[model samples]
Target: MHALVGDAVRKACSELFSVELAEGQLQLQKTRKEFEGDITVVVFPLTKLSKLSPEATGEALGKFLTEQVAHVSKFNVVKGFLNLSMSAEFWKGFFAAALKQDDFGFASPNSAPHVMVEYSSPNTNKPLHLGHLRNNFLGYSVSEILKAVGHRVTKVQIINDRGIHICKSMVAWKNYGNGETPESSGLKGDKLVGKYYVEFDKAHKAQMKALIKQGMTEEQAAQQTAIMQEAQEMLRLWEARDEATIELWTKMNGWVYDGFASTYKSMGVDFDKLYYESNTYINGKEEVEKGLAAGAFFQKEDGSIWIDLTDEGLDQKALLRKDGTAMYITQDIGTAILRFRDFPDLAYQIYTVGNEQEYHFKVLFMILKKLGFEKADQCYHLSYGMVELPEGKMKSREGTVVDADDLMEEMATVAQEVSAEQGKLEGLPEAERNQLFHIIGTAALKYFLLRVDPKKNMLFDPKESIDFNGNTGPSVQYTYVRTQAIQRRYAEAHPGFNPKEANSEGHTLSTAESEVVAKMYEWPAVLRMAATTYNPADIAHYSYDLAKLYNAFYQDHQIVKETDEQARNFRLALTYKTGVVIREAMRLLGISMPDRM
Candidate 1:
């Protein structure tokens, strides 16, 4: 609806005023607090073209706009700015259309190319942490936004289920676990395995200290050699298909998978495919050999294979270690090859990783291009900055890392407490209360993480972020509930008045309600921008703005007690449509709306 008005204004300016406006020149921007209008237009850019004073230009343009733009019912000139007030009839049409459409703000069928998003690459040695939660939420929300914008989206996850760290866990388990299972330990697989990992680190450090006290050089002490030996023994057992060791590994990994599945379910994340390192690690070794044969890769005397990417502004990347085992980059290359073969027409491959690995992805993509993968240039590193606490960085070694499950439980507990304290759970059953906590908890976490730009490091201020008061998830959820409450009351009071009935009388535009409706109409543009930029935070910010506008409109305007029947019904219909749009927008950010605060 806003687009229609902008188009009409632009056409009038171009054809009637002899001014060639830019595509987005006549944007429906928000007015300042002291301003009388809801949407403001800056006519400063048109002053030169009009060859007149700024105020004169604004006045002339405003007059032309009101006369020519059918959707815009009124306009006011404020110095060099033009504020547009859209017609109520136009809003009624827009609201009715929005209500009739199943997909509120989705793009047309023929819009854009396919994009692949990869996220949540958790290591096998440990379960997910607070950092992984942010990555997962951003990736999932962006994928959903892209799909809504008519882009074919492939959501993928690469499991970092192999490495020395994984081997360390295996070593600890083999030597000290005594064939104990996760069921026997009564712990999640990742937690059970993570415990032994900490144990190994402690023992390994003690052994190193002992070796150093004996006056041996760090390398000569063979401290690392002992750890590697233990790891190698376990790897040998695993490769030989030792039934006892395999059984334990499989059981522990299964428990971890179960834990991860539950977390994903609560967080509302899903993937089209899951790529495992164990399956893809060997694929690139053959590709490396081919690259070596083609002279694209070089081998050292000790047999380590590498690609020199310095010519492409990247450091040399190790393709295979001297021991011929696949490294992290090796598996990623193989996965890319396999994915390309699986989906030949994939236009973009996005890797949602941390900013610390920026150099790694840069090198990885350069190597792929060097190896003659033409589509390698299309790969993108969606490097989100780290999530630090208010104090500083979260260091796992210092035990400051927040576990994903524990964080969710904490948020849920807080939600429950706030609900009870506010006495909002009066009529909600116990089961319903529990469900609301889950929804509110997930929303708080997701909204807190997604409200900031992905490229900048965000400080998770525990006290401020988890608060149910102003500018948080709970606030937005409360606004939604309040709107729903009003609608429910109105429906009960006027049993014969159907919300779905199309109004022939047309709406009468109020200054405040028009502003709210205009903001609501901009949802499609916001979704499109976020999708194109791969920034889910844009949607988060946009939803917050919409909720704020709705809250202001609800507080100052009486929707249920309007005197005019046509005006009352029209306003109720507007509120109903706004509620739907807001709910859909929140869902795209993986947020749930409660019917009551």
Candidate 2:
């Protein structure tokens, strides 16, 4: 309906005023202050065609809009801007039509293109940290936004389950003397396994220091040559299916998977497909063989496999090690082949990974294109910058890594405390209060992680990130809850308040309410832009704007106290619609709004 009004306004401006209004030239913006009007249209772009000042151009456009646009009630030309007001009758009709539609705020039927988003590729050797949180947030939100805009989206995760890193954990677990298991230690699987990994580094360093004290060369004492030997031994044990080794590995990996599932559930991220490095590494070698046979790659002197990407302005990438084992790039290549074979018509394949691996994806795409996979050109690396703390980058070596599950738990505890302090848990049952805390906590984390542009590095200040006030997720959730509270109060006051019984008549528009209504009308535009740009931050920003406008309206106007019953009911209806939009918007951002928070 808003698009219809904008189109009509554009056509009327072009035909009646001889103003060459380009498509998308005229923007519908809310006035900077409440005193101005609802939807403002800047006519400065038409100054050249009208051969008049901007104020005069605005006056001319305002006249055309009022005279021709049926939905527009009136227009005021103010300082080079045309502030056009929608008739109350138009909003009533708009809401009526919207109520009839089953899928309001969803994209139209013409949007169809399959998008596959890959994220949360955590190594099995360690649990997810703060960085993985950002990756998952972006990936999950992007998928939801695309789905809201009528695109078929597939969320995927690639588990880096096999590598030298896994061997590090395995070596540590083997040499530590104690035959303890995660079940025996009663620690979360990822944390238990991570402890062993840290132990390995400590032991290796101690061994190197001892060797250095014995007057060995620096390189020799560093045990750099022995690192590969130890790694290979671990891999050999793993491949030979040593009973104790396989059992430990399987048990540890099982715990990590279980822990990850819980974390993903709390964060509202799920995968349609999961690719494991263990399953795909051999496949990568097979793909490399195929490429070599097809003249897409060449062999090194030492029996290693490599792909020359110099012609494409990229350095040559190694596909396989001299021992015929797959490397990191090799597994990715195999996965790409498998994915394309599964969904040949996939229009977009986005790898939501850290910015550190930007070059990896660049080379991967180029190699895929060179290997005759045309769909490689459509692949994108949504490279997001690192998430740093106030002090510096998070380093696991320094024991400064923020575990995903631990952070969530801490946030939930803080939310519970805040809820108690606000006396919001007065009559709620213990179970319900706990649930509310969880919801609020999850909302805080998801919103905080997603509010920033995905490509830019961001700080996750523990103190500031968890706050509910001031442009935070809790603020938006509180707005939603406040709207619900108003509806509840109104229902209690007028037990017979039936929406169908009240006619939206004599509902004169106040400046604040009009601004809210105008912003409300642009929900579709926000969704379209977010989906098309594949930027979830756009949705976050729009949701914040809507929340701010609605909160301002609530603060200034008394919906239930209005003398005109019809006006009160009409405002109630607008509040209801705003709640609906807020819920949908937050859902796309992978955040949930509590009914009462």
Candidate 3:
């Protein structure tokens, strides 16, 4: 409809005023709530073509559109704006057609350029945390949104498995672990490794304090600490492929992988591909060598490799240390290249990392461009803000961060308690009841995290997220269930009823119906906007608003008991369409909806 109106306005200008208006010169918006029309066209820009007063220009365009556009029934001019209303037949036709489209908001699958999204790059030294939850959900949701809009998306993650961080855990376990495995300790593999990582930190700190007491400076103490030295030596040995160090590294990383698989399964996120630093760092080194050969990078006196980017408004960045170890940016470079190689038709490479690495990505992308990769300009850093608990921020080395698995379990527990208090799903079989709880819990978590704009920091409160009344996911889920209940009752009372026989051709819609139908008309545009902006918050908030609109309509009207069969059937059809949209929107967010609350 918007496109149609835009074209009509453009034609009106060319015919009436003899002026050609470019694409963006025509400004159109959905009529404001205070307006008495469906679509509003701004006449201010077209005034240049008309050379008339704003009101006069608007009047001219409104008359031209009403006469020329087929679906445009009438129009009115206010100030410099021309508001156009559609005919009843137009809306009826739209609603009837939309009813048949099971995938209305999504485009048909296309052989478009592939886009790769990398996220949840976790280290093996620690378990997944709350920050990782947001990353995974955002990445997965963005990929889905892109796919829905006809982009071929590949979801991937790079495990930070080989680093000094992992070596810290290995060194700690070797020095103080009494040979206890995850099975013996009754802890998850990632958790066990995380425990040793924390132990290493505490031990290193204690050694630092002792050296400080012996009159060494803090920096001196940090470099000279016994535990720190051991960790460093362990990293060097692992790099050298020492038998004992490599064996320990392999075993510990394997344990962490098992733990990660379980957590990922529980969280309902998956990756199409997985890269590891251990595999890609060497590739990065090769790329760095190629850069040096091409004069894109220079070798320092100490054998370290650095890229001089001063001309590009950045300082020199080190690609490799003197000891020949790849830096984080180095691995990223190789990963980007490898992904492009894997998908030769790739269009975009998006890295979902926190905001702190914004500069690092800037340098990495610049270097890739300098290295003559055409797709380097397509590389983008989806930098998002950190997530903190209500009390404060989280620290992984201090073991103060909330574990992702634990937080998910806690969310389910809260869901159960809330459901029990509300007395929903009572007397159901245990398995079915538990499934509902999980669905509700997952909806709550994902919606809460995705509701806020990804660029801003958020404080996730489980209590606020699980509420049944507000703009939460469980509330949306309950609304869907309510719609199902209405349909069930309708089925029981009128078994032979067919919505096609309702006949809504000439019926005048009430205010509630108009509002809801208007909202439904906005879904395709909203989804397209979300895909363009790479923001799931757009979809999340739209779902909430749609649910609220349906609930408002539900509250004001009695569906099954209306005396007019046509009106009742139209209301029932509205409810059905709302349910379909809610289910589809929640699915894009990676949330499941239960049939009953």
Best by lDDT: 3
lDDT of 2 by residue, 490-551 (tens): 88967877654567666777767766777777778888888777788887888889899988
How many backbone clashes are present in model 1? 0
Ranking under TM-score, best-scoring first? 3, 1, 2
lDDT of each: 0.80, 0.81, 0.88
Top-TM-score structure, candidate number:
3
Q: For residues 298-409, write the lDDT of model 3, one tens digit per residue.
A: 9999999999999987898899999889888888889889888888988888899998788988998998998887888999999898887676688665456877898888
- In candidate 1, position 52 carries an lDDT of 83
Superposed Cα deviation of residue 73, candidate 1 (Å): 4.5
lDDT value for model 1: 0.80
Off by over 4 Å in 2: 1-56, 73-83, 99-102, 108-111, 214-228, 237-247, 463-465, 492-501, 561-563
TM-score of 2: 0.91
